[model samples]
Target chain A: MQEKIKVTINKKPIEVEQGTTIYKAAKELNIHIPVLCYMNLKDMGIEHNPGGCRMCIVEVEGARNLPPSCVTKCTDGMEIRTNTPRVLNARKTVMELILSDHPFDCLICAKSGTCDLQKMAQDLGIREIPYQGEQSTYREDTSPAIIREIDKCINCRRCETMCNDIQTVGALSGIYRGFEAVVAPAFEQNLEHSPCTYCGQCVAVCPTGALTEVDQTNSVLGALADPRKTVVVQTAPAVRAALGEEFGMKAGTLVTGKMTSALRELGFDYVFDTDFAADLTIMEEGTELLDRLGKHLKGDKDVKLPILTSCCPGWVSFFEHHFPEMKDIPSTARSPQQMFGAIAKNYFAEKIKVKREDMVVVSVMPCVAKKYERSRKEFSVNGDPDVNYSITTRELAHLIKQANIDFHTLDDQDFDQPLGESTGASVIFGTTGGVIEAATRTAYELHTGKKLDKVDFKQLRGMEGIREATVDMDGTQVRIGIAHGLGHARQLLEDIKKGKSQFHAIEIMACPGGCIGGGGQPLHHGNSQILIDRQKALYKEDAGKAIRKSHENPFIQTLYKEYLGEPCGERSHELLHTHYFDRKKRWIKK
Target chain B: MSSVKVELHQKDVDKIKAIAKEHHNEPEELINVLHATQEFFGYLPAEVQEIVGEEMNVSAAKVFGVVTFYSFFTMTPMGRYPISICTGTACYVRGAETVLDEFKRQLNVEVGVTTEDGKFSINCLRCVGACGLAPVVMVGDKTYGRVSPDGVKDIIDEYKDAE
Candidate 1:
């Protein structure tokens, strides 16, 4: 159906699609070429090859000069020499020039071990820089979720591509030109003053120390060291799916048990799972969905049908800033992390006989936005936050290693009782299209008053950018929409705004592949297969779970029967659900 | 871009909306709207950029990026006397760096920043096609050619009492 081009690289011949770049063709031959300022998430349709850095250059036989292979397309019978002395010399020279401008402080740099630019220099065997001049510098901007050390930027524009093109948040861009050119928020304003959703996708793709997550490991360690405080830690489902990679394990090795053991060993008084709150989220949000459906079916036109899920903090802030007019359309359910916090600080704290201020609820999440979510004033009682510290999966790994715990040889252990209990439905919330499927499993049985023969909604699962499915609830066909990246979410919201949406409900997550590809997860380094593997791990976990439905989880049932009277009762409203704000009004303060 | 706060007037806001409307409020029309706003306000402050972003349906950060990318756009207000020095190859060969350093030393102000009294601001331009009068300096509309570092004191004294 498509044309193919035969290209010869390093005397090896290969045939690929007509538009395949030389970089991909070289990869086909297993000839690895070092790259900088080039990132390609082909699965999500994202490719940022600015060609600003000349590190991936190759010599074309017929061409006058070497061209960067990332952008140079493969043509018929094209001869490309990747490892020639000339090409190597040029690449090394470019890398040296980059290093000359960079600060020689890798030992203390935030991205020290994982920095791509550092790896590039090592791969090219660069020892010293012959060229030297004034290096560009700017004030470091420390936002709630991200840190921008502009001096380390290589003008890669990967963050720009992810922000403007993938997420459509448009919070960052290239601000200047030439030697002094830098990428920053508008007017170089701090991210707090910018229209940043604090999604942290920019931090995820950064090649240098220019962008990184706000390190909260020290605060978490401090809370653990505080003898007066009871530190209760909750690990998100997605964190288990990917945290293993930080310990030299495979991408999809589910480290749930080991992570729980590590948290306990690291001094957490209680090791809980956010999946419990995810199940709790289903209890409230599913009820709201059914209530809206019942009212809509009964001719109550005021009820907002097509209720959107409110589990993603990034998506919540995105809508708050971009689509505030439709704020009431989404369910008022707080994220699983916040729900765990509120319950830990209030319901669980009281059950354990610990005072609210004495119990510090820490969240082990696979997201950077969770940091910003924990900072929301409304999610606090008086001045004390619901979650005292939110650490990333990467940060948790650092702590486990810092404690000298041999993660590989350590025996797997189960989570604590009551608070750690979770169901299969909540486990699936780690991936895209998982939330709606989980909701469907619970909503269908409740609405139809029948048992589901199969729990897995195979029709509603995939890595597709935008997905649609229909579930027959008795005689009614309930339409469902699922989207992962915010750009796709924008399309669904735009359809709703135009009165053209046919779905009865929708689920949206800000990051790619849901929380598995979160900004705070172990960096995939442009390999999208890692994300796919992470998604599969979550589904694998869901399949192995004993209870596959949220409502059927006995602990959640007990939570409702004891502390929270009903699904959407007054207590649930106060502790589980929260409101949205029109952030456009507060975007930039005068 | 400067972080100083400036409250925009209703009429200036209306003018920005009109300029954006003239371009159908498209994201591509962002530069045109920014140019018109800077012309009206004499600078592109954060407040004016916010309004342009609102009218254009573009993010404010993106608008700031475009303003900073081009050397022509200024975020802070220009002083009563804006001084521009050419630093092109022709001028640099004729002691332009010395002239720039002399100005910085005399005014105790950084390039692109105004004096505390708002009387003078210094900037550098690449070329003005005045190689015949190499190392040229321009104060508002007046141009001084063949300028040396020794003449910097006299130039500052000329504008010292003009206010």
Candidate 2:
């Protein structure tokens, strides 16, 4: 065991483990030392305390000057004062200095209320800026998923850590120095020009308006306002698990019924569940996994083992940029969001006797990458997009508030029929290891032609970055691997590239906790416990369902019988499945 | 998804690969590899950085970040006669700003930018341990000490005649 140390903060002695940061020690004493750049999501092992922002500095006794408490380790009998007059003066001055260089457009800023800097300024009671200077400015960059407003960047480097250290995408880093320093792509290029995966993890970690999701709410509103448009909305499985946090409801409060009612009240002609499409994804993806497994078992040497799941658009972009050689290794199944869009336009539109152009399909997702995924040209037909637009969970919350809807007291309502019904397997898609578990549920029974004694794959579930399990498929051992963050996915991909992988199937989600911890989910503000709560809520929803298997869902069975004909059939291949591209060598000049 | 594609010759690419190999292709050797590559190529361009990233197993954005962080590195090529004015506190107090402004007026080039003719470029540097020289300017390796705003025209003329 490590040695223990005692530290005095505000004359209250507290014992902590050796090498404990002063900020953490103060927390034990319930002394809140406000921090800006310091973020600690201990559960995910992601801590970004650079001590660059001097906001968390405290007065250490006998020290020449105040030192940053977040990085400074505690020593025995060290006396620290966090709210001394000297410290407060220094902090206020530092805030003013930061504000001097920052744009004073808080009222009009996108992150006005939720901005950390704004909250810090208010908390410190900073009234005026005594130190005024020329504010730095840069051209705003708007990509399909995120917006880069460098002028609002405070140089905290949180996004830098998330982009390079966690996601391993390496699209953003600290460039230049001093007052001119800003996190940007190489050559100060636009994110679209860089190898950015559009994961939006950077946006999720950004404390200010420097990064934000591309607002498509206005266009969605425009579509709703159009008389010629029949706006149909699809809510992702992850959305319902966490959307309640925006309305002052507890995190992980399952608000599925209220969310559906709100969408219907928001003028959406039809409110469907993306979970329904998730069931369809399992049917198609599970069959593909079994087909590949069968081929490999028959000694088909050319067949790729460990068929990777292709549901995450961020993960797809990651491999397209970094591991283009393994592009063909991932299953060709489209994500549930895209599948729902394709079906809604081609199948559902025809069923309703409405032209595809007149049917506007909007998806409320827990991911920003879904916005980019829907924009891919392959998902379109003759200049018309399969999905009209993708809005984030935050955007949906804003829309609900804009419409003056009281979300908390609304009566629970069911989703519109035909495209609304889903199974327990689909609800679990919100959490890590869920897609593979759901796939295994169907593939195991299909492969062995035996009934599953218990549908739950207990071994295939957890929050680990990378997890492996071997299932006994009759007499065969079917190995399965699950990875949730892209960085973890990279390790698995590297092993596969080196022919070191032994698994037959793998599931990868770009976010840290599957879609529950997605980039476009309600801001958890680095509190990982919220993610755990969201994951628990999804499992609870799953357990409460009557049907636990995707193949057993009557609606999914009806979809196959009436329209798709069969899983991985010719029509399904055209709409539900898609191909991958080697984008490593493709560099477009602006 | 637009970017300016940077292309390099095969020989230069091979040289970069060799430098990376010399550093054992370790990601931690990124800065050292960049310095060596920059020493050979004069400046670290985007394409050269990309090649170094490929060799060193580091991201080009990260490499660019390190290259841009230190003021010693340059992305654009230096001119034939790179003019540097010391803008240290001592020099600035001694009217080095006026001298810098004169150079900009005469060369028609901003700091860190090369002239249209590619013969002259201007940049500001910290003190070169010549506090006695107060306001100093360097053309290539030749230092001109105690330079006044009036002497700015003479300095440019001297370099022009030499070229």
Candidate 3:
């Protein structure tokens, strides 16, 4: 092997392993070599990619031009000047080029005050571009959960990296040439018509306003204006835990009451909780797991092991496109977002004495794919979709701002009764491993005929990629696996494919750290621990709740007796249960 | 695979229906419907756009609007061999621009535009992490290092000979 290269960065001599980039070496010395696309490996979480923004330029003693420290490997006896004037000019020039066509609308952009590119430009003191050119204007793609305005794109390719490399869903990529270059789906197609799933992972990594959650407040207002329409809103469990961030609240602040009041202020007929439907989902899904486990025990060869959670639509659509054969492995749980939609049109419509056709069920979610999920046919019951519209937490923030509501001073309020009541177990559905833990709370107790020692399954919690734990219940050891992020899910699925391990149950969410760290959550910067802080707030909410299990939710118990009849009853199957289909061969283009 | 032959299951059909409802313009579902069709079939066929428009309660024009907005989706089947030239900073400074010019001349196609023969499609990339070998050109699965303008002819010839 070649000897390690010794490089001097800013008068300090450091020995870097061969193949380590200058940025990687500087990072080891705790030197901040200002970067636009150089995210730490841990910050990358699922998508650990190299620099693509070309903002971290550095000068090597013998090199002709500045090298992008992100991808350039260190050489033997190299003297690197990370803060040289030449390096500064190169980096500044790159930043200026990016801003030439960029729309300077940070004040209105959701990514404002928190965007990486904005911070980089501020650091570089790029107040004005030398070349002010006519910018390309794209009609905003105001799809259900995401909005795309291409003019703000720096073409950093971080969104493309995350979309293709991490999610394994190459939804957004670079197309065209020269000044006409842009990031978009093939043929500049609208995202709504694609299998994009509106996961908003692209929006999460976008350094500019080029990729964002589509604004639906105007459409929502239009619906509210029509006297013929009665709007009913459902708030997803994850949205409650993270929506506070938009109102200047700290990450993970539980503003459920405040959110409820805000929705009421928006003139909604009813403020329902998706958590309540989450409880219903657990009841149906937990029973399905138990039934499947029984079948697996009886030597049924067709039984799907490592039953993955389907609460995350990104993960669902991912399996649909790439690993379609594994579709049977995912539980037939139409995520809480969809469950609320199904029940709102059928049950809430009747309670409000409004026709199902006239009632519009709007969902506030911490996911973009919920928009895609709400549009799915299986999510519909009573000849119409249970939910009519889906908006992200960020979109709700925009709506609040558009309505000119004093969000910071809104008094906390409770959700409407009947469909709004939820258990502690349902609340935890916002974070990673929540579905598995919630299911175990009910499944473990129902099978063993004993209460769980503690509702807090610490082993399944946290932001780790793959977590494994074995629990002994009724003299039977239940092996469970929890994985967040699609990359990690791909690894665990590979292990299962190789017959490495057979998990009794597994939980998987497409975005990292499950719903609380969902693609549609408020934008955050480069701090892995910050993501964990957001995740912990969700567990804290679950811990504080009085009823900790889905089976223990009083409203769910009442619903079972009055409407659904049983967890896996005929009515439950018709309204709650769903199925998955395959599409792997179609997308396996090489 | 033809540009527009998609075989969709009930799940895909249902997803399109839900999209139609959410946009309050079942017509809006046409865009996503076309997207789903393209993902399923590798490209959108002209006939399916009409079917998608009808199913989702949107006009074919609206479907076309959606089809032209996002980047990850496509409306045409990719060529047999896809050539992605790196225009990332490191590669560009090392003369990747000349390599791109050579490919454009040789393939008779501009960046992002596939050839009429369907044998090759040339596209540019931000970066591919192989910056050590700057001015790199990727032809299908193979990566050519130290790609000079003159080297472009040999690389395309190598692919042709193999076929």
Candidate 4:
């Protein structure tokens, strides 16, 4: 056991493990040393303490000067004064200096209510900035999914930490020097020109409006208001888990019914669930998995082992940029969003006698990457995108509030028929490992031609960065690996590249806790418990469903029979599957 | 801050790849690889940095970040005779600012940038350890110490005629 370092915070006794920082020691004594740039999501294993923001300044007894509590180690018998007048004055001055260069346009800022810098200022009672200076300004970078309002950057380097360290995307970094320093892509190029995956984790962690999602709520409204267009909306499974938090509900509160009702109230003509498409995804993806496994077992050396899931657009972009040589390794199933869009525009539109061009398929996702994914040229036909627009869960919540809909008071409602029907497996798609687990549940029964007694595979469920499980599919062992964050996926992909991987199929989601902890989900504010809570809510939703498997979804069966032929068949491959491309030469800004 | 875009040909990419390869193509060897690439290309532009990043397995954005952070590295094309005027304490007291101003005026280029003809670039440095000479100006490998502001035109003319 590590020796506990005794410390006194505000004359209160506290003991912490050796190497514990002053912030952690003070936290034990219920002393909240205010911080702005310090974000530690213990559940997700992301701790970024750049110590650039001198907001958490605390005076140590006998020390030369005040030190930032985040990076300052607490020595044994150390006396830390967290709320001293001197420390308070220093903190105030530091915050004032930061605010002096920052714009005072919180009224119109997208992150006004949730901005950590603003909240910290209010907590410190910073009324007026006595210090004024020339502010650092830059042109706004508007990408398909994210916006880089660099003028608002406070140089916290949180987005830099997320982009480089957490996601390993390398899309952004701190450039220039001191006052001119701002996190941006190489050559100050727009994000679209960089190797950015558009995962939006940077936007999720940004304390200010420097990084934010491209708001498509206005576009969705325009589509709905247009009388010529028959607008259809699909909400991703994770949105139901986290959307309630936007309405002041608990972190993991499942608001599926209320969310469906609220979308209807917000004037959406047809409210569908992306889980239906997720079910279709499982059907298509599971078949591809089994097909690959069957070929591998038959000693087919040409087939790529450990077929990777293509549901995550961020992961797709990651591989397309980083590992283009292994492009053929991932399963070619279209993600639930694209699958929904393809079906909505082609099959559903034809059935309703609505022209494909006249119908607009909008998706309310728990991801900003879905915006980029929907815009992929292959997902569209004749220059018209299958999904006309994709709004985030936060955007939907904003739309609900903009329309004055009482989300809490709204009664529970069901999703529309045909496309709305989903299963337990589909609902679980919101969480990490849920896709492979869902695929396993269906693939097992489909391959063995027997019903699975125990539906839940507990081994495949957890918050670990990389998890692997081997299931006995009757006699044959089917190895499964699941990775949530892109960094962990890189590890697995690296192993596969070096021919060290033993898994048969892998599920990879770029965001931390899968879509429930998506970049576009209601901000967790570094509270990782929110991710766990959202994950739990999704599991609870899965447990309560009558149909536990995607293959068992009755609506899926009817669709396959009436319109689509078979899983991974000619029509399904054309609609539900897409090919990968070598994008190595694409983002090189030469 | 230089927004000049230059097309990197096959040979240029190969040159950067060779530099990165000599450094074992390791991510940790980014600084060393960049130093050599800058020395070879006369400057570290985004195109060259992108190639270095590709060869080094590091991100192009990070390469740019490192290049921008250090005064020694430059992304813009340096002049044929890149000029560095020392602005250290000893040099500053000896009128290094005036010397730098004269160079910029004669060259018609800002610091860290080349003139329109790309003949000269004006940059300011800390010190050259030549306090005995007080103010010092350097062009390529040649160092001119105790340089007055009026001597800047003579220095530019010498480099222009020789090149």
DockQ of all predictions against the true structure, Cα-based: 0.42, 0.42, 0.04, 0.53
Model 1 lDDT tens row, B1-163: 5656777667777888888898999998888888887877778887888889888988777888888888889988877888899999999999999999999999999999999998999999998988899999999889999999999899889999995
Report the C-alpha lDDT of model 2 over A1-590, residue by residue, as the tens digit: 99898889999999999999999999989999999999997877888999988999999999999999999999999999999999999999999898998888999888888999999999989889988667888899999999999999999999988888889999998988887788899888888988899888988989999999998999999999999998999999999999999998999899999999899899999999999999999999999999999999999999988899999999999999999999989999999999999999998999999999999999999999999999999999998899989999999999999999999888899999799999999999989989998898899889999988798888998888899999999998999999988899999999999999999999999999999999999899999989999999999999899989899999888888898898999999999999988877432232
The single-chain TM-score for chain B of candidate 1 is 0.88
lDDT tens digits by residue: candidate 4, A164-200: 8888999898888987887899888889978899999
Model 4, position A176: C-alpha lDDT score: 84
* RMSD of candidates 1 onward, in order: 3.6, 3.0, 12.1, 2.1
Q: Rank the candidates by TM-score, best first.
A: 4, 2, 1, 3
True-vs-predicted CA distance for residue A405, candidate 3, Å: 3.6
TM-score chain B for all models: 0.88, 0.87, 0.63, 0.92
Query: Which 10-residue span in candidate 3 chain A carries the lowest summed lDDT?
Result: A581-590
- Summing lDDT over every window of 10 consecutive residues in candidate 1 chain A, give the lowest-scoring window: A581-590
* Tens digits of lDDT, candidate 4, B1-163: 4756778788888788888889999999999998888889888877788888888988888989999898898877888888988999999998988888888787777788788887888888888888899798889989898899888888888978773
Residue A493's lDDT within candidate 2 is: 94
In order of listing, the candidates' clash counts read 2, 0, 40, 0
Candidate 3 ranges beyond 4 A from true positions: A1-33, A41-52, A58-65, A72-90, A103-115, A122-127, A132-148, A175-181, A184-195, A225-229, A381-384, A495-501, A584-590, B1-163
Off by over 4 Å in 1: A1-7, A15-19, A74-77, A585-590, B79-163
- TM-score winner between 1 and 2, please give it: 2
Best candidate, DockQ-wise? 4
